[model samples]
Target: MSNIIIGTAGHIDHGKTALIKALNGFEGDSTNEEKQRGITIDLSFSNLTKGQQNIAFIDVPGHEKLVKNMIAGAFGFDYVMIVVSAAEGIKPQTVEHLEIINLLGLKEIIVVITKKDLVTLEQLEEKKEQLLMFLDTFDFEIKFIHEVSIYEKESIEKLKNSLFSINNSIKQEENFFRYYVDRVFSPKGIGTVVTGTILGKKIELNEKIFICDSQMESKIKNIQVHNINALEANISNRAALNLQGVNINQIKRGDLITKKGHIRGFDGIDISFKCLKDKKLHHNQTYTLFIGAKKVEVKVLLFDCITTLETGYATLKADEKLYCIFGEKIILRNANDTICGGKVLNPIIDPMKKNQKRRLLEALDNSDFTAAYKELLDAHKKGLGIISSTQRFALSHERAIEFANELENVFVDVKELVIYPMETKDFIKDFIKIIYTKNTYALLSNASINLRLKWASTAFIQSALDELVNEDFLTRDVSLYKNSNIKEDFTKELETVFLHRLKQEDITPTAPYNIYDDLDIDRKLGDDILKSLTAKKQVIRLQHNLFIHFESLNKIVKEMKNIIKEDGFIDISNFKTRFDLSRKYLITYLDYLDNYSNIKKVENRRVFV
Candidate 1:
């Protein structure tokens, strides 16, 4: 079945809720406060199904003070039903709602002139002409202008048929699933259940979802679409998810649910904004930001100037982390008045200079992703990851790679999703060359070198190694790269170097892995060398990581015996008093005394046997 969300917008007491009830036979104003007040207070949800077509209705409150609640439901709308009363014609809230829908880029408009029975035939016709003229000023496809009175059943059926005839569903073709929570509640038996429209992709039962605000993970214990049990829900389907591993207090309206690692939150985001008619957005001014059902107070900082402007680039500095995607629509308001609307350009915060940020935002505003990538690559010289392309640039991985391939003087690691400036390759080459120059017996591989340069991918490190091999600076022996100047006896030379280095350090020797790193050799080869030395008794192994030359062990044993003779007993404290070494060395040396035929163990102390 195809699903579409249609929201109602108009002034208060315009029959928005009654029209919904008449069409779907579902009561939208279910709460006591709403029933007593005879108005829609919060967002109410209902749906009407015809064959395989399911049209969900999000009945938003039309009161001026409830505009925030209206915006929360508007983000999920594919089409809007403008409810206008025939007696009053167009009102202030109607104009504001139309402007907001236009700013949100909603193109489909279905104007429903309600209460036609209350107005005379000529008066209703005159109101229809006025609404048609006003709607022409905005960009919208007037699907139809239908006059309806809830008292008449034929009018509601005609409107319902017109809606069911919509064959096209505006669904986002994204690979990840995202749902914005609009309503949250806990039942007596069931756990926390949240209702919202499925976006981006489909979500299946038993799938794990991540809550953005609480940073918690929950599983879908059950799924319901329009109050019908289902195993999965697709884009545009109004779903209620019974979640496990989270409390009702943890989730609320405006929280986001998505898969792990699909989104990265930012405390600030960049956008290209245009103010509403006759309104100016000032720099460094705080406003209420609404996106994906979430509303936050944000301070707007215009990129071009410190003064007020009608349209430009800006950054919204928010107090809380915002989980948003590129190209997502945002509504800005000051107090209760809708000020401006914007589209997110950069959802990921770039740590850069202000001027660079401006250039990047300027390029992004123009949809010049290549220039924006270049600007970001300048600051992320180590490498820039394209895995975040979906959230950062609204481009898929393949599309991002296509743009990356168009750039010059950059190395694109397609498999790793990393893009490095060409100069970074030279930086790696220079650093590796210094390592080989300092240690002629250095033997390394891409994996070993990756440990030293953790920021660079193994593919990037291999590229640098291959470049060195072309220049005859290094020779490849399978996966290992050896200095070209090294002799065939390099293995023997490495073993001798290790032994001599151990003797030089005497009683305090570095771990075998550190020795290998300092000498710029493969860890496996270092292990083999240490094994050969220990097999011949040329070195002594006191602890797992402690290895010492035989002569150094003998000398330490002699010094320990002298301490035992003077103190009549020697333990870690007395051994440290003489050698002034760390506890690791002191304990190892004192334990070695037990191997002596003349010594015996005395609890925590060592004495003559």
Candidate 2:
């Protein structure tokens, strides 16, 4: 089935709710306050399904004070229905609603002139002409204009059929799913439930979702579309999801629901904006930013201008993190007055110079991702990660790789999703050359080198190591690489040196890996040399990573026996009384006493046989 969200926009008492009641028999004003005031206050949701088409209606309040509520619903609109009363023609709230929707990029418009019974035929035609001329001033394509009254059932049915006749609005099949919570409540017998329009992608019945604001994960316990149970909900469908693990108090309006790791929240984001009418956006001034049913107070910082700008690129810095994606629309308002509308250009904050940021924002605004990639590569000379392209540029992994391939003198690691300027390889090559020059006995591997250069991937390090091998500067033995100049095997020399070093420490010896570093030998080679010494009886393996020279072990055993002879029984406490040693050495020494059958164990103490 196809789904579309159609939102109503107009002045107060323009019959937007009455028309919905006439068409689908849904009374939008469900609250006691709304019933008493006789006006729509908050957003009301209802749907009409005919055949295979489902059209969800979002009835927004037309009161000027409720414009914020209107904006919250406008973000999910696929098409907007502009309701203008025949008697009132066009009012202040009507013009403001049109301007806001136009700023939000709503192109397809359905003009509904209601209260037709209140006006004569001649007056109706004049009003229709006036509405057309007024709408033509903006950039919306007028799809249809209908005259209807709540008393006329025939006109209501005709309008409903016309709505279904229109082609289904196109919804981009994005890879990630997200929905902003407009209403959260826990029904009696049910768990926490949130209602909003599904966007970006479809959601399944039992899918796990992350609440961005609360930083928690919840499962979909149930799925409801327009009060009917469903197995799945598609993009643009008004859905109510019963969440399993969270309470209703934990969620509020504007909390984002999406798959984990698909989004990154930022306190600052870049955008290209234009103020409505003659309004000017001042730099360093705070404004309410509305996007995806969420509003945050932010200070605007113009990129190219100093004080104020009527239209241009700027950054919105909020006290709290804003989770948004590329090309998402945003509205800036001062109190209740709408200022400008913009599209999110850069949702991820990049640590770049002001000039570089301006250039990147320009490239993004023009949809030139190649320039943006180059700008990022220039700043991230070490290596740029392509994995963030999904949230940063709205490009998939394959598409990001395709863009990387188009760049000149760049190395693209598709497996690791990192892009580096070819010149970065020289740094790795130079660093490796110094290591070998300083110590001809040094043996290195890709994994060992990555320990020093954590930012460089193993694959990248291997590429540099390969270049060294080609240049005859290094030779590889399976996975270990060593200086090619030293051809003869130095295994015996390394074993003698390490065994002596272990004997010097006597009881407390450094870890094998650390000893390998001090002697400028590879870790694997050091392990091999220690094993050879152990086989020759010159070294004793004490623990998993500990090795002691034979002389040191024999001397420690004699000292431990003296302690037992002096104290009648030797335990950790008595041993420490004679020799101040760490727990590792004391425990290992006590356990090694078992090698002599002459010593008898009595619980935690050892005594003579």
Tens digit per residue, CA lDDT, model 2, 115-231: 999999999999999999999899898878899998998988889988998758655667788899999898899989999999878899999999998899999999999999999
User: How many pairs in model 2 have backbone atoms within 3 A of each other, for residues 3 or more apart or on separate chains, i.e. clashes?
Assistant: 0
User: How many backbone clashes can be found in candidate 1?
Assistant: 0
Give the per-residue Cα lDDT of candidate 1 at 489: 57
lDDT of each: 0.91, 0.91
Give the alpha carbon lDDT tens digit for every residue of 288-323 in model 1.
Answer: 999989999999999879999999998999889999
Quote the lDDT for 535 in model 1.
98
* lDDT of the structure predicted as candidate 2: 0.91
TM-score of model 2 (CA atoms)? 0.95
Task: Flag regions of model 2 displaced more than 4 Å.
Answer: 304-306, 566-580, 601-605
Candidate 1 lDDT at 486 equals 73
